[model samples]
Target: MSTTRLFNVYCDESCHLQHDGVPVMAWGAVYCQATETRAIAQAVRALKTQHGLSPAFEVKWTKVSPAKAAFYLALVDMFLADHRLRFRGLVVPDKGVLDHDRFDQSHDDWYYKMYYTMLRPIFCAPHRYRIYLDVKDTRGGPKTRKLHEVLANSLYDFDRKCIERVQQVRSHESELLPIADILIGALTYSNRGLASNSAKRAIVARLGERLGSTALTRTSTFATTKFNILLWQSREALG
Candidate 1:
């Protein structure tokens, strides 16, 4: 059996913020086994070649065009299924649930914090996890540094757990890392600004009920936790 100690996880997020009147929505975390990382890298290299993706292409190049973006989205799902890799995250911010002002004030940062929290529990046990977070902002400013600091601060306990490290990489150079990024982006576009209350509830419920049922560790602990997070969010929104 493949031990969990050698796992290297890559995570990305989309629609993570509620700047201005924009509704917050959709966050995703995708991962492959540490042992399988090399294989997954090879697969992505082949896909890039087949699709003529150049090394010099800008980050989020797949997102520049709709058709090409969708293709990569499908490709990501295919890779996950093929490798039996498990993932868990949420699509949030439909109308009446999340207001821009409220979200900003809460300082929750949804998936940014959620991914950190989720990874925390996994890294809790005596195993090592080297997590790679794909940089969402290339703008090179305070916002980007804040994100780096958040990730670093979140992993403060990992050094004691025999866990080696946490890293952030540019989305484009990260190859397979952007797959999760695009999935969340697609989710955001499909939900359309999270303006519909019914759609928001349905999306959150599905994430909790379905996506959370996936196998992450020897047990489906994290998936179950994700479901609970969805349910808790719903209750909090309702009250």
Candidate 2:
């Protein structure tokens, strides 16, 4: 086994729930050490310098149109591969196959459910990993608070294992945002691979093959059944 270092993960997901038209997908990033974090950041900085790109993650993602977005995305993928980093992600059905809309009325709840399900597998390790999530909510907003609460609440603590921490950071300001944006954009492109002839089918196939049906089925079922029970019980109590 590779001796675990001080692993810090910078993770994000695309297609937060069942994709309305396509497949739902989530991605995880693992940095084995602080140096790796710096290296990743520096590589992104280099890209920004070479491209005259802005510093923020959101801008990097939203500023570019889809075709050019894939160009920068390929660079990010190359960087990840060169660094020997690890990535985990998932793609599953949306409403047609799994009814996330019926389960989560609020966007907050829906995203939180998806986020938790994505994090579930990584929590099994014994080592300490600091998780930094790119924040979607605006600054000084109730939505940020809700994100924090939802993240905290979703953590599963077995009697034997506890999470070191789960932090939702404001990526709007971080230089890392650009890097993360490219990563997430790539993931979005990946999950939507059902569309384009130029799409990376080999990678998508590998991900689909690794993910299998069990994780998707279990997570969807759990979210659906739990939400139904909660709704039913809430109505009962009100009555």
TM-score of each: 0.62, 0.56
lDDT for 8 in candidate 2 is 62
lDDT by residue (tens digit), candidate 2, 1-239: 64544566566655554435555454444344545777766666666555656544344544555444454645545544564454444343333444345665655565556555555555444555566767654543564455445555555433313444456666664445445454454455554444353333433333335444232222233433111101111222347
**Clash count for each candidate, listed in order shown:** 0, 3
Instruction: Give the per-residue lDDT of model 1 (tens digit) for 1-239.
Output: 53445666666665455554556454455665577767776666666666677644443523435435434544554554564354554545452465436556454565346555545544444556676776545643554445455665666652335445556777756656765664455455444533334433343334334344322111244445322222114446668
The candidate that wins on TM-score is 1
* lDDT values, one for every candidate: 0.51, 0.48
